[model samples]
Target chain A: MATLELQGIRKSFGTTHVLHGIDLAVAEGEMIVIVGASGCGKSTLLRIVAGLETATEGRVIIAGADVTRLEPKDRDIAMVFQNYALYPHMSVFDNMAYGLKIRGLPKAEIRARVQQTADLLGIGQLLERKPRQLSGGQRQRVAMGRAIVREPKLFLFDEPLSNLDAKLRVQMRAEIKRLQRRLGVTSLFVTHDQVEAMTLGDRLVVMHEGRAEQVATPMEIWRAPANTYVAGFIGAPAMNFLAAELVEGGAAAKLKAGATIAFADGVHPGGEGAPLIVGIRPEHIQAGSGPGSLPLKVDLVEPLGAESLIHGALPSGETLTVRMSDCSPLAGSVLPVVLPPASLHVFDAEGRRIEAVRRRERTAAAGAVGA
Target chain B: MMHGPIDATRLAAAERAAMKAEAARRRTDIVTHAILILGVVLFALPIWIVLMGSTHDVGTIARGEVPLLPGPYAVQNYLTALGEGSARTTRVPVALMMVNSFIMALLITVGKIAISLTSAYAVVFFSFPGRMVAFWSIFITLMLPVEVRIFPTFKVVSDLGMINTYGGLIIPLIASATATLLFRQFFLTIPDELVEAAKIDGAGPLRFFKDVVLPLSVTNIAALFVILFVYGWNQYLWPLLVTTSGDVETIVIGIVRMIGSEADTDWNLVMATAVLALLPPVAVVILMQRWFVKGLVETEK
Candidate 1:
C-alpha cells in the first residue's frame, strides 16, 4: 500500500485544458474515487496517475517517490480497464499469469499465484477457457483477478463496471468494495457514476468542468454540500432551489412565492433584503400545513413501489420534486410542504455556500440564558 | 361459425397449389444440380486433358489430335520427366527444378510474412516522426507492380551480386505492401486497452508482439502464406531474368524450356511437368481453405 499525492496536476491537449490544477492527497490504503460528468477530466487525471498520459504540469508522488517521469510498470501500478481488456487469445490462466511471466517469475510460482487468484475470484473452473467463452460478469472477474494477482502497489480502475448490465454492475460493485477492503491497497477509481463513487470511495472527489469541486466523505457531501452544484448533482430527484430575499435582520428569508420561512436554529449570514438561494433536498421535505410551509400544486406522481416521487410546482411557478411514500396525491391538488430550516442550505449569488447566521443568534440566546 | 358444406372446388384448388409448389421446388433442385455439375466439369476438363496427354507418347499430342484416353506410356513419361527431364532442353532434372521452386516459394512466403508482421506491428503500435509518411510510402508500392519496376530492381539485385542466388529471387519479391496493409488493418482492430494492459503487465513492445499480437494473427498469416506461396511458385519473368544456369531453374520456367524453337517438343514430359506444377498449390488451398476464407472475411471488418 502507498499514499498517493497529486500536487497541482494540470493537463492540456493543444490548449484545450482538460484538468485545471487538481491537488489531492490520499492516505495509505484509502480508496479515492473521482466522480464527475463525462468530459470533466476525471479519466484524464486517472490516466496521468497511471503514467498512460503525461501531465502538462505537476508531480505524481506515490509512496513519497516523485514518479512523474516513470513508466506505468515502473510505478508498480495495475489497471483494470473499462472493457476488461483481457487478452482474447489467451486462456484465463494465461491472462492472469501474463504479468508474472513477463516479470520472469518461476513457472510453478506463476501457476500457484494464478490458481490462488482464480479461487479468490471464483473463476477457478474457467482457467482454461478463453475470454470469448466467458460471460460479461466472468470476464470482469478475470480482469480484476489479473490486477489482483500482480499485487501492485496501487490499483487504478477506469469505470470497470460501466460495461456490465445494471444488476451485474451492482454485484461487481459490492465485490470490488469487499476485495479492496480485504487487500487494503491504495486505489484510485474514476467514473461518471455518482452512486458508484458514493458507495466505493473512502472520500469522494466531486469534480466539475476541470476542477475538484469538493473532496469529502459521501455523507458529509450529501449533508453539507459545498456549493449549489454538489447539492443538485449528488442527490436523486435533485434538490430544489428557490430565489429569496433575506428579511427580518438576516433571521428569515422571504421566498419569492411570498412565504416567509425562518431558520430553525440560527440566523443566516446575510443582511436584510439580501438576495440568496435556498436549497432543500427532495427526501427532507415534510408534508403538512405549518407556519413555514410552501404550497405545492401537484402535477405528476411517479410510483416506485416503496416511495413515490411527486413532481409539482411551487406557488412561485418553480418546479419541485418530493420523495414521499408510495401513495399518489391527486393531480392539480395544492399540498402544503414544509422545508425544515435545519435541512435548508443557503448559497450566495455566485453559488458558493454562506454560513448560516448562527453567531448572532447563538450569542443573543446565550446572553439571555445567562441573565 | 356454422360450417358450410365442404367445397370440392376449394379442396381441389388447395391440392393443386401444393402440387405446383412441390413441382417448383423439384425444378429448382434440378436446376441447381445442373449448374453445379457444369461448374465441376468446366474445372475438371483441363486436368483430364493434361492427364491423358501426359500418358500418351509425344507423337500423338504433336499430331494435333488431342487424346481423350490415357495411353500405356504413363509410367515411362513420368519417370523420364522426374529423373532425366527432356533430352531436347537443358539437361537439368525436373525433380531438381521442383525442389528449387519449392524452396523459393517457401522462402518468399515466410520472408514476406515476417517482414510485413513486424513492419505492420511497428506502424500500428508506435508513434514516431514521419510515421504516416512511412506508411504511405509503403502503401504506394502497391500501385507499382514488380513488372513496372523490374529493370531497376534487377539492376539493384545484380549490383548486390545476388543474381543466381535465392536472395535475389526471394528478397525483391518479398517486400509486399498488400500483405503489410492487411496485417496493419488486422492490428488496428486490437483494442488500445490491450496495449495499456500489456504495458502495466511489464511487457515491452517486442514482448507484447511475440506473446499477444502474433498469436492473434495466426489465421491471417496462414492465409497470406497460401497466396504468397502460389504467387512465388508461378513466378516466370523474374526467375528467368535472374537465374541463367540450369542449376537454379524453377519448374514453371523449366516447363517452357522443354519446347525447343527448332526441334520437336517433348509434349509428354511437358504435360507431366504441368501436372507436377499444379499439385502443390491445389494441395495448399485445400488444406488451409478454412483459415483462408476466415482470414479474408474477418480482416475486411
Candidate 2:
C-alpha cells in the first residue's frame, strides 16, 4: 500500500482541453471516489494516475517517487475498466494470472496467487470459463480478481459497475468495498453516481468541469458542503433552490405560485431586500402539516415502495417535492404543506451558503467577545 | 351462400380453376429447379474441365476433346510430362518445382504476416512523432499497383545482383500494403483496456502484443496466411521477369515454361507439367480453406 499524489494535472487532446488543473492525494489504504458528470475528466484523472494517459502538465508522485513520465508497466498500479476489460480469449484463471506472468513470476506462484484470488472472490468454479461465457456479475468479479492478483500498490477503477444491472450493481458495489478493505490497497474509483461515491469512498472528491469542488468525508460533504454546487449535488432528489429576499433578521421567501413564507435567524442578515436562493432537501418538506404550513397544490405522487414522493407547486409558482411514507387521500390533491424553519437553507446571490457561514462567524465573534 | 352450395354447376367451375392454379405452381417450381441446376453446372463446369484436361494428353485437349469424360491414357501423359531427362534447357522438375513453390509461398506468407503484425501494432499502439503520416504512407501504397512499379523493382533487384535468386522472387513482394492495413484495423478493434491491463502486469510492448493481440487474432492471421500464400504461389509476371532460369523459378513460372518454343512444341508434356504445377496451390487452398474463411470474416469485423 502506497500513497498517491497528483499535482496540477492537466491534459489536452489536440486542441480540446479535457482535464483542467486537478490536484488530489490518496493516502495508503484509503478509498477515494471521484464523482462528476460524464466528460468531467474524472476518468481521465484516474488514467493519469494509473499512468495510462500522460498529462500535458503535472507531476504524479507515488510512494515518494516521481512517476509522471513512467509507463504504466513501471507504475506498479492496476486498473479495472468500466467494461471489465477481461481478455476475451482467456479463461478466468488465465485472465487473472496474465499480469503475474507478464511480471515473470514463476508458474507455480502465479497459479497459487490466481487460485487464492479466485477463491477469495468465490469464482474458483469459473476459472476455466472465458469472459463471454460469464454473466455480467461473473465478468466483473474476474476483472477485480485480475487486479487484486497483482497485489499492486494502488488500484484504479473506472466506473466498474456502470455495466451491470441495478440489482447486480448494488451487490457488486458492496463486494468491491469489502474487497478493498480486505486488500487494504490505496484505490481511486471514478463514477458519475453520487450514491456510490457516498457509500464506497472514505473521502468524496466531487468534481465539476475538471475541477475538484470539494474533498471531504461523505458526512461532512452532506452536512456542510463548501458551496451550493456540492450542497445540491451530494444529496438525492437534489437540494431544491428557491428565490428569496432578506428581511427583519431572517429571509422572506416565496414559492413559484406566489405563496410567501418567513424564516427566523438562520440566514445571514445581508443588505435589505437583496434576493437570495433558498436550498431545501425533499425530506425536509413534510406532508400533512405540523406548524408554519404553507398551502400547496399536490400535482403527483410517486410511491417507491418504501417511501412516497409528492410533487407539488407552492402558491408562489415554485415547484417543490415532499417525501413522506403516508399514501394519504390528499395525494394528487391540492393541499397545504409546511416547511420547518430549521430545515430551510438560504443561499446568497452567488449560490453560497449564507446562514451556515453566519452561524460560524457568530460563534467565532462570540468566542472572541467572551475572551 | 346457401344457394351457391346447392349449385353443382358453380362447384364444377371452381374445381376446374383450382386444378388450373395447381398446374401453374407446379410449372413454376419446375422452371425454378431447372434454372438452379443449370446455374450449378455453369459454375462447376470450368473446374471439372480443367481437372480432366490436366490428366489427358495435350493432343486430345488441343483436338477439343470433351473434358468431363476422361479418355484412355491419362497415366501415360502424366508420367511423361513429370519425367526427367527432358530436352528443354529450362525444364523444371515437378518435384523441384513443388518444393520451390512451397518454400517461397511459406516464406512470403510468414514474412508478410510478421511485418504486418509488427507495423500494425506500432502504428496503432505506440505513439511517436509523425505516426499518422507514416500510417497513411503505408496505407497509400495499396492504391498504387505493383505493376506500375515493375520497372523500378526490376532495376532495384538487378542492381542488388539478386537476379535468378529466391531473394529476387520474395524480396519485392514481402511487405504487403493490404496485410499491414488489415492487421492495423484488427489491432484497433482491440480495446485499449487490454493493453492497459497488460501494462499493469508489467508487460512491455513485445510481451503484450504476443500474449494479448496475437493470440486473439489467430483467425485473421490464418486467413491472411492462406491468402498471401496463394499470392506468392501463383506469382507469374514478377517471377517471370526476375528469375530467368528454372533453378529458382516458382510454380506459375514453371507451368509457363512447359509451353515450349513453337518449333519444338510438346503439347502432351506441357499439359502434364501444367497439371502438376496447379496441384500445390489447389492443395493449399483445399487444406486451408477453413482458416481462410475464418480470417476473412474476422477481418471484416
Model 1, span A1-371: residue lDDT tens: 99999999999999799999999999999999999889999999999999999999999999999999999989999999999999987889999999999899999999999999999999999999888888999999999999999998899999999999999999999999999999999999999888999999999999998899999999999988999998888988889999988888878878887688887756777677989888999998879896778889999988898998999999789998999884578888988888878888888878888777568778898999999
Once model 1 is optimally superposed onto the true structure by TM-score, how far is the C-alpha of residue A253 displaced, in angstroms?
2.4
Estimate the TM-score of every prediction: 0.94, 0.90
lDDT of 2 at B224: 82
Residue ranges of candidate 2 with Cα displaced over 4 Å: A14-16, A250-269, A288-292, A327-333, A355-371, B1-29, B54-68, B85-90, B260-264, B292-301
Q: How would you encode candidate 2's per-residue C-alpha lDDT over A111-217 as one tens digit per residue?
A: 99999999999999999887888899999999999989889889999999999999999999999999899889999999999999999999999998878888999
The DockQ values of the predictions, listed in order, are 0.57, 0.57
For model 2, residues B160-249, the per-residue Cα lDDT tens digits are 999988888887889788999999888888988777777777877888788888888888887787788888888878988988876786
Least lDDT summed over 10 consecutive residues: which range in candidate 2 chain B? Answer: B83-92
Best prediction by lDDT: 1
- The docking quality of candidate 1, as DockQ, is 0.57
Give me the runs in candidate 1 sitting further than 4 Å from their true place: A360-371, B1-6, B261-263, B290-301
Q: What interface Cα RMSD is found for model 2?
A: 2.8
